[model samples]
Target chain A: MSLLGVENVTKRFGGLLAVDHVSFSVPEGAVFGLIGPNGAGKTTVFNLITGNYELDSGSVSFAGANITGKPTHRIVAMGIARTFQTIRLFSDMSVLENVLAGRHCRMRSGPVSAMLRLKWQRKEEREAIGKALAELRFVGLAAQAENPARNLSYGNQRLLEIARALASDPRLIILDEPAGGMNELETAALVNLIGRIRDRGITVLLIEHDMSLVMKACEQLVVLEYGKKIAEDEPDAVKQDPLVIEAYLGSGDEDF
Target chain B: MKPDADNIRKGAYAAVAVLWILAPLYLDKYWTDVLNNVAIYAALGLSLNIILGYGGMFHMGHAAFFAIGAYTTAIVNTAWGVPVLWLMPFAGIAAGVFAVAVARPIIHLRGDYLLIVTIGMVEIVRIALVNNVFGITGGANGIFGISSPSIFGRQINGVVAPGHYFYLLTVFLGATIILFSLLEHSRFGRALKFTCSDEVAATGSGINAAGYKLAAFVIGAVWAGMTGTLYAAKIGFISPESFSFWESVIMFMIVILGGSGSIPGVLLGAILIIGLPELFQGLQQYRLLIFGIVLVVMMIFRPQGILPPAPRKYPVDKLEKQEVSL
Candidate 1:
């Protein structure tokens, strides 16, 4: 009944074993968090789930359909959208244009209809623009819609990426280090945005190094270390788990 | 003040249109013919722009499509006696079909790899024509004495006046520009731009990157084929030499030097690269050297070209003021 179910997923890059037997289930409308140290394969898990990489073993099911080894774009169209760890805006495009590009999956007008500007195409385009604007407004970027994406500040660019993901009308949205580069204020804003995104009845899954944002926003957490799951529990319990602490601070007598 | 600026712009555009319409009357027959060539090249440049400029594909074999279109016209006209104008659309369809067939297998190749493969494709097509693969290509010498095209049952031979061909080319060029302008602003065009900017991000947005790339190639090929038909009709002859590898190179240069993704820029590029050499006929031997120098200088100075594409804008004045005050 879960929206996304990963069963014994394993991926190896030669002998590295980037992800080893990772399993988790994300319930519908839940904000799930994946936290890990550098090279802990959190991003690799995301890549596997999004079909960006082929899994060595195990299956992934989204919305009750097996999506194992499906192409990235097809997986995205099947109600799952994601942002990158590093920002990947169509930099030369305007902010609104970037969001409109995300709406590409939802629309069906091809080259001939587009070239001829059929009535239905125009109507669909107008609706798409309206929807894109609504998403930009959701992320507080409606005013900067006409500005080129590259011209926006780093924080605003991150928000634009979120808006773009939202425009795809996905059932579940994944955020990969959505708060990678931000001050306290920007991080706080991102947390609020994530909360608003979840409030819209869309499930949220995020990978974050910002402990405060992750702990505040995620309803449940999964911890990984050395490509293996260390702990999976509520935020308060995961924060206090001995394995999670050891993974973050190392096994030595290091300061908390 | 805005209205005055608009008026000035309108006036300038009107003056240019008037000059273009009156050119054949004032210019000599030789110069009129050169203008005709410019129009043809402009159309060809626009065609290549759809792939190289918008789709961000390195298509170094566009001349193959051109040859396909020209040969289809030549063969169909000679055998079936179809009116050259009526056959133009079929020529475009033939070239588009050929493009889909050839580009399907190699559309996955990107950047310089695709470039190398396309260069080989052009050679393959050229050699096929030279060998007269179908016997209908007329071998290396090509077909000759093709009938002139007629609009509304009026023949446009242009043998004596040259104005007839000039008008026809201008109409073709104008129509091409209009059609391309519509496409450049549409959803399909935006998809091509997104694919060009970042293929991975575009795919993540659910764009079939390969499909859009193929569409761009086919559209570009269709345009090139139509231009080839026009070229054959104007010359009343066809030859393997007309659609050479160098011809593809010139079309690529026209798009790049004019600023890729800019419609007006490509037209200007066609005029400069095609028209300038003709104007400097007195310095005939140094033409290639001069072109090289000019290209190098352009690259050093205005690399984005004479008219780089401006940012796209939408008319959403009401929504513009509704920021959340974040």
Candidate 2:
């Protein structure tokens, strides 16, 4: 059985169809990639999966449970976490607190216990903080943990967003445009990070415009055009798929 | 230095509590009356802070809760001869309950609409208190002969005088500050701040926005009601006239000037808004003008108020590896 599955998902904004009858299933521990041209509804797919946008029609199942119409937080708690294309960190919050906010779903202390800082709550807080620190370290951001999230460099901010999502201990992680703007060295580092995430047994579905990074990091790739999946296959195969090559490389009528 | 801040804060609270408790032993009658008013206003300002500062609910109808508490205490005490002390909590709870009921739907409105609704709520409450002539409410003239309850085996009515009441008010105010301080630091407090800063993000993170918002409304209402009890006892009289639009404005000014979301800032704001007017009563009408100028200057120069939220820090030692995309 697929670990995460979407069947015939269709999203519409008025007369415009953002994603039309798109269906895909990701097996547990697979590093999957969703790629497209600029207007290919890639981020829209992420939104549909993460409950950030309501689906006009379709169904989403995670871990064999129907999650269609579930609120974002509930979806997150159900072991699916996502990072945004824009990197939405709590700007005024501390680096650690941003992670703690994600860990909010994991906390089990009663209000009264939290108030009195009972032994259990204190221990839990310390443990959560430790976990947050570990996640930050996992993303190579330990040195900047004490600073406000907004003050971090743009790349660190993106890393912080990923760390925050990871802190939720998701069964499946969706990263939207994880490598939208990065140099060669940074893309290489992201390839390693994606590998580490998969090694930890978390499935990843990432959207990317950077073909090199996506092709290197993703074992399987799906190509979308005008809100429809044009092709899906192994990276090497998809690269040569006539539809993908024609749609993405622009029919080779011009530059190499 | 690690322990010094906590110690100083505790010391400040302790010193204030002691001074107020022992004040009747030394202060003259005139000073006692002034102190009583200060206590009442301080309590009112603090309660307003819970809503505006901590909960991020901007309420201009807080004085309405104060009016409700005062009226509840007055009616219960006068009609049934119940001790004012026993009636205080009941009044506060009653006011809180009313706030929750009315605000559940009204709080959905934001900014100008919220301001209008709250202003309307206060006016309606005031009118009800005054127009209910057939009912137990004394109307425009107000409730009188309302007596204070006994404490420590002595009837604390007109006998020990306003000075004793001043002491009681101080103790009540101290307890409130401590209670509010704890509430602010709790998960509830954090949740409220999150909701205030970004409701969408907060709700997306799994917080029940409606629940937190309603809780803030009710908690702030209860605080307002408690302050009313203090006012009723301190003055031994309350006309509908006392709880007015201007009073609500005064409370809002205190919270904003002090800095919303900061406990110490609210207290400091309360002192300035309440104490400054009293100290400059000789300035009379011009005193209000001066207060307005001060508020305007503060808003223009230091919009974050006397104390902004302290920045939170990340633990730098936790970074594992750097991945630069560019």
Judging by TM-score against the true structure, name the best candidate: 1
Alpha carbon lDDT at A209, candidate 2: 85
Q: What is the number of residue pairs that collide in model 1? A: 0
> For model 2, how does the per-residue alpha-carbon lDDT over B1-326 read when each residue is reduced to its tens digit?
56676587668867866776787788887667767776777778777876777667778988899898988888888788887888888888989999987898887776678888999999988888889755878889999967776787676653358776776777787777777766665556666777776666665555566677888888788878877776776557889999888889888887889887776677677777776677787889799798889888999999989866555333333433323221
Tens-digit per-residue lDDT, A1-256, candidate 1: 4999999999999989999999999999999999998889999999999988999999999999999999888888999999988899999999999999889989988878876778999888877888888899889998898999999999899999889989999999999999988889999988898888888889999998788998999999999998899899999999999899888877887567
In candidate 1, the residue pairs with backbone N, CA or C atoms under 3 Å apart (3 or more residues apart, or in different chains) clash, namely none
TM accuracy, model 1: 0.96
Winning model by DockQ: 1
Cα distance off (Å), candidate 2, residue A8: 2.1
Question: Model 1 off-target regions past 4 Å?
Answer: A253-256, B3-14, B318-326
On a 0 to 1 DockQ scale, where is model 2?
A: 0.30
lDDT of 2 by residue, A158-248 (tens): 7887888888888888888887666678778989999999999999998998899888999998899999988989999998898997887
